[model samples]
Target: MGHLRQIFLFLVSIFIISTSYSQIEISGQVFDDQDEKLIGATVMVSKDSVSSILAYGISDANGKFKIAVNNESDVLFLKVSYIGFGTFKKTIQNKAQTLEVKLSPSSESLKEVIVKSEILRQRGDTLSFSIAAFKGKNDRVIADVLKKIPGIHIRPNGQILYKNEPIQKYYIEGLDLLEGRYNLANNNLSVEAVSKVEILENHQLVRVLDSLEFSDRASINIRLKKDITLSATATAGIGAAPLLWQTKVTPMIFTKKQQAIVTYQSNNTGTDVSGEISNFTIKYAGVNFDIDKKDWLSIQKVLVPPFSPERWLDNNVHLGSVNILQRI
Candidate 1:
């Protein structure tokens, strides 16, 4: 009887292990017709629920993106597109399991709009928005259009959440800036530079040691336009709470392979106000960020730190805390 019990217990343990773990690692490289790697490509996946992006990522400078999927899916789409290359797509079946895709370039015959519209993405679970979707009625800031995208909610506290999860980071053309703290309602990023705003869900950071895959966490990547301009944007006025004034100016300058991004902002209103500046530069090919983000509340407070005690007590009499939830 004791021996019989041991066999039964073994079977139960096996079942538990099988039921509790169901995941697959999908990894590969992208190459052009001549076999040249295409860097900074976008990749995404979602469940057939049609609800939101389930998994998303971008190819590295070596032209590679990695994603992990679980259980099963009806179909999978793989796409590849570069600035000068044509967009290509393919379909995969569940039975096929692992995959490696190669995207080809297109001729200049059709209109540029048609080419950019699709821009080579996996068709099955990926969702996308055209540049047209971002055009505002008048001079709407970037946050205006972001509010329209499904599965995205710009909170009153100025934090951007995708599928009930706070986006761990933000990047302009794959460059991490301000750590995704101000993406919610602030119009810091110009729609023009944003060739695409990739929402990488369940993103994992890749460990270079080649031995730490099991311990790495998800990360995010942003794809920007091929060429852009140097410009600044400013918005200042008195709102209901922050009765003083607010101003933000960012001087952005870039080259094909280099950039100097500087942000200088100052606000003295009511509940929350301060001055800050940040600048960083990275090689287009050398580095990328893979973050294991935690404690989102701390990050938000840091982004919109409270004003001085004097500022808060002064507003306490009648005015409420400054509501600076619109700009980001």
Candidate 2:
């Protein structure tokens, strides 16, 4: 029994020596054509028979990779692939235990990836929409063009909604042309002058607190064409008998460092032009300050029944407003 046990131990030691000799450790470094280390690159070793993968590893941040192969007799092939880079394949001989691979940039792969129907594209925190893709023949003004955008809607009251939420700020060339009353520019601005519309989501209004503060609101910016630095819109109409007339003139100028918009609107057709005026009064802030006596007097008197103010106030209503914005 002692002699048999000695023989069994000798055979087991030989088997372990042979197994260790057959196994080989492979190490390599991957780099780009510019000699920059490529992280997360796939390094694979497969049998020359094209059967199964023998070993695999991913390049680390230092572009170093290590793999192990258990079969030393089988001829192997190494493959390395990464995004925006060309694939590399080479035969691994029995004596070659270390490798260094440099992958070239794949321009052919980039050409094959063509984006033909991309109307909206996102970059960082801003989303840009191509104007030509959304504009139509009947889109005479910017308001008309905005209605055709997928995630944007223009209400009947000229309010702008983005993804079902109202936009907080409207900008022209990175300048807030209208403080809170942006309907003036949206309704009157010409669509032909605009080249693109950018939506800044989760925008931070205050520049100093941008990193510390966060907001859910979004802001819109209009990018005009290169040659369209100056644009204007004018409308004039007249009717006989009752002498009904309306006139609107808007002129705008946009530049890299300065922006200005001047508008004059006058109508007597019962249009509510009070929206153009800046009213800082908040209904829910619990601060009661009445600047207009007529407003308080109307609220104090209880009416007989709820009625449509539009029907009751059928009289001629003359409204004239002038708004000018200049940023330097």
Candidate 3:
């Protein structure tokens, strides 16, 4: 009891504050049987080794105390030990607030139930996820993050189909990054740098001068991480056949009013360079925006106005040009 008294010193209301999935803070105070707020109560939570400053807190003069966490604290622990009284343990299983803990003098050395112990200082989670959130189990490339988007699809022949057709454009961080032969960007762009995936369906590249003309199509816009937009990426990888040793070097420079992306891809199979330069400044609201039923049927008219038959000798030079841009 002598050493125990030294451990619990004056700590009574022990509170730990932290955040998890969203912005959540965990707080609690401790008091004694006499309703006296315990001061100097010890609280400790072991955080990931990336950094120290784990969960911790103490009590105040009013016989009250508190603890807090700034990050996810699902695995926290709270231990309270004082002299002349037996130590107690509590398990904070989930994120909760307004906790009231009352400690009594030592009657027996009863051990705390591991499951019921509140030693886990805090509880919260901001990012809740599951495997189903991803597009395909075969999403092996960064572009796969885009393909999994609800309205997007990848045609078997290498064409990027959004809402089941050729995509008009592709962008990253609101910057047009690929022009044609997008396989390079799809294969080289790291998904880790993407913060949001936008699927533009029945996309109209131009806002509008007059409703007299219209084109219905789709596109993919990747919102890259802030750090990625202003930098370039050069990747070299060696994989199996169908994809042997290859080098993809893409150097991009972007500014407010202008952007230039130079992509060079080479393999035993093929070699291509895609350069996109435009004075157009891009500003977007969101991807996968829902169009009303009336807008959908109306745009469908512009998209497929009287499909003329394609002869065996019919040349798709325009479609081919669009396909070239899609290959990146």
Best model number under TM-score:
2
- Whole-model lDDT, model 1: 0.51
Candidate 1 lDDT at 157 equals 47
In candidate 3, what are the lDDT values of residues 5-84, reduced to their tens digit? 86665443232122233333456666789878876454433343223324445444554545455446565444554444
- TM-score per candidate: 0.43, 0.54, 0.35
Q: Candidate 2 lDDT, tens digit per residue, 188-224?
A: 6789889889989888877887789887778899889
Using lDDT, give the best candidate's number.
Answer: 2
How do the residues 225-255 of candidate 1 rate in per-residue lDDT, one tens digit apiece? Answer: 6565454566655555526655655655544
Candidates, ranked, lDDT: 2, 1, 3
Ranking by TM-score: 2, 1, 3
TM-score of 3: 0.35
- Which is superior by TM-score, 2 or 3? 2
Candidate 3 vs. truth: CA RMSD? 20.8
Worst 10 residues of 3 by lDDT: 122-131
Candidate 1: residue 258 lDDT (0-100): 54
